[model samples]
Target: MSASSSVAAGRGAPRQASGALWQALPFLGIFAAALILPMVSNDYWTLIATRAAIYWVLVSALNLVVGFAGQLAIGWVAMLTLGAYTTSVLVAGNVMPPVPVFPALGVAALVGGVFGFIVGLPALRLRTFYFAMTTLGFATIVTQVALAWQGVTGGGIGIVGPVLPAPFDTIFGFYLFCLGLAAFCTWISANAAHSRFGRSLVAIRDAEVAAESSGISKPRLLGAVFLFAGAMAGIAGGLFATLQSYISPEAFTFDLSVLFFIAILIGGRGSILGPFIATIVLTWLPEFAAPLVAWSTFLYAALLLAIVLLVPGGIAALLDFRSRRRIEADRTIVPRPELLPEILGGRKASEAITLKDIVLSFGGVRAVDGLDLTIEPGAVHGLIGPNGSGKTTTLNVICGFYRPETGSVTVDGEPLPAAAPQTRAASGIARTFQTPKLIGEASVLQNVMVGGAIRGRGSFVESLLALPRHRQDEAMLRHDALLALRCVGLGALADVRADRLQHSELRFLEIARALMLRPRFLLLDEPAAGLSAEEIRSLGGLIRAISRQGTGVLLVEHHADLIFEICDQVTVLNLGRELAAGTPAEIRAHPEVVSAYLGS
Candidate 1:
């Protein structure tokens, strides 16, 4: 059988539903045990199990912020404390009608969201160690305030929490109540991880510049994740307080915050089930080691250190390792036959990009000197120069990565309003980097999916709920992305990890991703950098096909033959200044261009 047919047959042979069921069996078993444990186990074990459920809610939210969003917020415990204290104050003061425990939970979420927003404002500005330090500072500040505030918080003494009416007041009822709530929170997180928002977050975590170039707003998305995580922490806190029937400053500490971080790291950062499993293990480990009480804390620390040192991807990585290899071995790439359209049929034609008297400098060095260039629609405009001739720098200036100190960049006749990567991308411009910036851990399909982040319309809530609009957008996105991949000869490799691609394949993958934008103008930097002679020939054909589609192409290439073959016009630069510009034949025949650039 052909390789493509074998791959298609192998994938089509599997019962998708049965595979999903097998994957979910562990979670189902856990839920079943949670339901029956209270009846079969002793009271102490039941209490431990109940507390584990609450921890699961908090840790799951943390996973989104830390794992996928790539924010190290160790101060999440402060939000939890705020929620518990808010519930305590309301119940003790009899401020509202006693309508069970749900109202208190709602109030806690509001309070948590507000505080989270407040903290995220300053915290999001910093990254890595600095961000962690800022959050750690907040944790310390909040703890001190809780201890010092004698009037409302009852000071170091503490306050009592309201009972959950009658039925829920009992241990069995409360255990069941927490289980249901934990499941709901887990469901929300699982949905977010698979949605467009989740993909954007992962992209931001992996490559901020690439993510922004694809039109994702990093700060805005991170703020929203911080807000959601804060709300979840608050809800978990309220439940904890109600279960214990008391709240004290001692319960919420910096140590507890670290524990939450440790749980997710040990379980796995990005996976949905990792935090749940980690919480159960960390919560009950101490109880199980009660006989060795003196060494319990030491044992916990040692185990965590071992996990960090041994399995950096967490326990989830180990479980997925064997399955991953097996899948890769069995997978076959099926090439798609449909090529990019010869003409951009119905799509609006791109206007010319004119750079007038462009001059860009870095200190004493002028990377791009006063130069005028124009790129017309439906043509390959090649930019050629020696090593330091500023070819790539000129592209950067045009694409908004660099702003020329003395030049006006215009589309058609109007000047661009801003020089932000996202803004340019939104204005019908897309680009590929010299290094081929694909997210290594992401599947080829997912890396391409990031191309349509803004184009895919749906709110975070709508996505979580799987609303009609969200589903429709997702389906359309998948189909379009697959088509783009096929056009670049990568349709069959969509399920493969991007890191596994060969050097030449990575170049094509980058082009495929850019094509998903349906860009009016495409910027290609060193698109022919690492390709073999045969690949370069194929690339020439692809560029021609794209240009015929009425989309403008700004190609920066070192291969003179390739440039002259496909490019209608060529501009040559020397020492950061343009030396010659004309039709390919005219520029190639110029005496100075031949002597200084083409070769002696």
Candidate 2:
């Protein structure tokens, strides 16, 4: 069997298993050490270890936000503080009847989730430093409220923490309880990290436009993550209050927030094990050097700077020894067009994607003017024009990236909502960018899997818990992603980071990602821009093969020869309007096409 066939046959299963084992080793070692710590260390050490576990319960979930989603949520300590106060006040019976500790913690989680969603609302409209500032502001407000609410919070005097009943009341028992909870948090977060939702988060971070085209709703996904993270943080706060036996505004400081945020950065983004290790190390650092505790924030800042300058990928990069191995110097993309049928799976859409009298403008310039086009299933349609001729613009219109002033995009004669790019994937439209937008830090296979974000049947909760439906979603996506990779000739490099691939390889990678959608209409935007002549020929062949499998291909390219060789019908655009439309032979001889586009 061929290499691709071997891959499809699950010959790589052992390697995958081995890789998974390696990934699990560090986490296993850490948790095992925590499990056995009481036997090896004193009660003082137990307290410190317990503190680390409590902090991890929060950081693990926050890793999904700051690390995976790339949202700068620096004020997550606000959730922790809120959780602590709510748990303490409810149990103290200051305002209401006394509540049990576990029940109070549960209520704290619910409250945290609501506030977390509120804090994260600005993120939907804001970005980067702006969102970070909002979180910090919220943290400050929480502190002020805790200080001013003297009756329930006890103001500066603070409130008594809840005491657990029976076995969990002892320090050792409590340590074990926190450790177990931390491990559970780690397991769930890791499950999410490996699921479609996890890959979608990374896609949103690095390739948002592509993510949108693939049907990842940033608002929905981010909102869900914030709620989960906040709940976890709230749980951590309850545990932390019990550990200290007191709850106060002073305990949840900005320094604590810095420690949580820095732990993720120092460990790495998109890695559970790295941040887990970082959390333990940072928790123990202050105890190791007592004098450094006063300058904890400064230490975190300095460490983050060093990590940024020296190892940008953080501990995760250091641990990824596989990436250090050199890929072959002379590599070629030998796509298996025959495998198209298997990947496409005979799921053919009978209707075409049609745009009628589309008029889109930017300021005073009409980017696309009175444009009408149709991409029929089982065919290749070419859109060709010179610079600024609105070829890409027209593709964007169909994809819902841009709302046309006067036009309608229809799939099977049903009008699609305007400016809703996230809806395109469900409508059976998938596209590639002119410049490949990909998660550089992610594996090629994972990047391709991002295209199938909408295809997963599992919900976020299912993914987080590793439920049956989530596992099935993952298995199906993984098998199809590998198939798509093999189809595009990137199967061998499936484990490699996407940024490591060559420019030509990235183009094919994008196509492979697009194929994951099983799109009825696959739109290519200047796909042949930076490819070699040979690679372009291979691309043209692949495009034709995809069309033959019942996928309507709308190829916007500058390579005239490629268009003539493969496209069934060619549409030539000049100044946002169709200048000529015919078969390759007819367009090749037309006087207007010859003068305007082909040559004088």
Candidate 3:
């Protein structure tokens, strides 16, 4: 690494720490105000504040699901209902011997986590409105079950809430207890929101295919988040029951569920403080106008509509002044080939990525048929053909997005598992889409960081607690992502939102993201699609430089000049079959190749 690069890396540390602290300020201020509420407020206000605190405990975790992961879990109140009833019954000894208050709450949380996983299972196979309906249906069933199960849940008459012994028995004392738990919840969830797992969640929400290519398992990550969120909701329910001193099926209304979901939306997707503040505000709004309590759902809907119309990005967007700053109009992507060695230093793949007799068809029409190709390490191999010639399909097959009917894709001569895209990154394969698949709302730095998600050694628990291993993983990813951005001429816009970049810049941004993999085989699909002449020249040089650094380059492009210019070997495809394969010079002059693809 150059001294200048080291200085740049060093300079990023303090800035990142400072930025984190800056983000922390809002959360600190909110909790700090909650701490002092008892000193100035009366009993009624204190109770209201306590309710808000309890609600925040649930919202803090739900933010990870609805906000960060972008799952529409509208009926989360089911978790709350389950938690409330479970704690009430256990404390009342309705099903067995009486349990202590804390133990009852713990049991409730366990039940919630289990049920949460069950509720979230549908999300893996279902999408959007269908998933939302499933959650809503679950909430309905829980209510109906509570109403019918008279022996255990006390039916319509309801059950008494568990009261904590001493220090938390008094109204204000109980408020303090709830407030403390709320603060603790804030800390842990915030820790997760800033970790690699958090980034992967956002990536999964916004760019699932890209997330998968980066080795993010949607089922595993979503399952973990659902479990955590459900547990928190359960804890919140126990607290809510205690606050009310009674629990009933009527208490956990669908309207309440709407409020919880809306709070996250009003606060903004992928924001902790936004949802935190929204939770408090929404909880207090009904109390402020007593008549609004009856029409809470309507008011909530109105508020959400207003927020969407006035600020589509919600409270988070309003708070983000940094992104509103104007970016430079004149910017150029000057690829730094020297940095290639630093990023790709340890990546040494001995064998090529080979495809043997591959056959993939859709609706009996072959997309790739009887194909054989090898992407050799440290070489530029270009695949070119007319439209629907299976160039991109071949790339997809190699990336494991599509399974071939009869073939094998191997790395180091070991066959890659068919139909498993997430395993490709581990096999040292990384690729960019024909159209750039990126998390537009996230920063350029964050989007690039997504590509290195599999590189993190920390577990979800480690990230949730902000443990040493998680911190190390974060620092390593940040440094490497920065290095990637600098190499691809995107360092200046690291903090900028990806959607704000120009077409050409987005193209390079994809390359920057791909570099984060330190891939042994880098497959690019028409990377020169939207580039200017000079930009295309720079991209060609970067691709060639990456190939020279011991990474295999599979270039799928329509630009004949670029193919002939950067590629050492060229293969032309026509109707899912190879037309010609030779050195670029030989392919460029072949009579049949010129007539078929290069143009007469």
For each candidate, what TM-score against the reference?
A: 0.92, 0.97, 0.98
Error of 1 at 61 (Å): 1.8
Whole-model lDDT, candidate 3?
A: 0.91
Per-candidate Cα RMSD to the true structure, in Å, reads: 3.8, 1.8, 1.2
Q: Write the per-residue lDDT of candidate 3 for residues 271-325, one digit (tens) a residue.
A: 9888888988898888879875888888889999999999999999999898899
Candidate 1 lDDT over residue span 1-600, tens digit each:
335534643564465346557767778888888898988888778788889998888887778888887788877898889888877777666455543467878888888877877777775578888888887888778778878987777778887876676677888888888899888887778778877788889888886667777888877887888888888888888888887777888888665787788788788766777777888988887776778756655665787789889987787777665227533334322323235662134688768999999999999999989999998889999999889899988888877778789988888687875467667777777889888888887788888888878888788878767788777667656666767788887877877878777888888888888887888888899899988887888888888888888889999999999999999999999989999999999988999999999985
| lDDT per residue as tens, model 2, 292-342 | 788888888999999999999998889878788888879999999988887
Model number with the top TM-score: 3
Clash pairs, model 2 backbone? none
Deviation of model 2 at 578, angstroms: 1.8
List clashing residue pairs in candidate 3: none
Candidate with better TM-score, 1 vs 2: 2
